[model samples]
Target: MISRILCTAFVLCACISTTILCINFKEQQWYYVISTVFSNVSNNDYIDIDLKTAHISRNVYGISGFIDVKRDIPDDAITIEIQMSRSVSGSNNYVVLPFKYKENILYCWLNNMYRDILMPSFGNCSNALQLGNREFKGPLVKKKFEFNKCLVNVDTLPKYLIPAIYKIEFKSNGLAKIYVQLIVRVYNKVF
Candidate 1:
């Protein structure tokens, strides 16, 4: 009788905790959405200046550009998405990675950049960054790349160094030229 009573109590506590968690999650609100304005340097070269202060020279191969987070994210943000766009059509390849601000510098926080480049079975991006498998399509025809549901550790990095830089790499197979644009969106899910 004692064991049965203890088991019942444990189950009840677990259920209550889960309910509270769900309620809190659902209460999350929209914080901010950052989109950039682009200037075309050439046929396949575009950069968003509002977010970063980098010079994108030669459209062929470069860092493309960086996105700056205008404000600090909430500690309880459940997911983040960084959407990217290009300037060529047909099909190609690309990768976008997240970086973190620590102390006074920025370091590659997650290797989601390699998630699409690396084989499907092998991905080294932080578990929080890789909510699930990621995919990227070539060609500027379809302009938009999204990093979905990034699991960020708020306790450790509630605020990033001003103007967080998210790097993007473009691999056009040396066949096509491409430019770029970006938008960042954060959300708190009910689930």
Candidate 2:
């Protein structure tokens, strides 16, 4: 009877160990890959977008670009909307994701929020703007704001992203109008 109890305990411990190993393996096997990045500007009288570099190399994506603000935009004047969608298999249509974020650029910048969800995959607007010799705090001045060699950090992404093609759209309205789109693929990494 003692031997049977020992055998059962050993089997239980083995099963628990196997389960832990599998969980760790699964977590380490998934990663993100950026497929494409596109930016568009409408009503150029107020602003112009110039994407100097937007490309994916070695499964990593980077964007180097600038936006020329023609006029000074006051705080609370610029509102941004972000929408995400997933591409349907064998179809040109995309299914909209349940996630949508809309807020004022000034508020987001001041609060230092939504770093993981912002464009060019930046941690914050102020920091991203600093790379281009600009600032996003207070009034947006009439000047060229830039973000150079901005990369998407996978570690900042959500823990679980479905393995599929996703398209993220960013729209800015109010003082100026701008649009940006990003297409990416989430896949499993082969060992």
> What lDDT tens digits, residue by residue, belong to model 2 across residues 120-177?
3654432344323233465767787676667655554565676778888878887667
| Regions more than 4 Å wrong, model 2 | 2-29, 52-56, 88-90, 103-105, 109-127, 130-137
TM-score of candidate 2 to 2 decimals: 0.72
Model 1, 1-191: lDDT tens digits are 99999999999999999998776655433232333334232222221222222233332111223322223322222122234332222133323334322211011112343333322222221111232543322212222222222222232332222233223322111212223343323333324
Clashing pairs for predicted structure model 2, backbone only: none
Choose the strongest candidate by lDDT.
Answer: 2
lDDT on C-alpha atoms for all candidate structures: 0.31, 0.68
Clashes of each: 4, 0
TM-score of each: 0.26, 0.72
- On TM-score, the candidate that comes out on top is 2
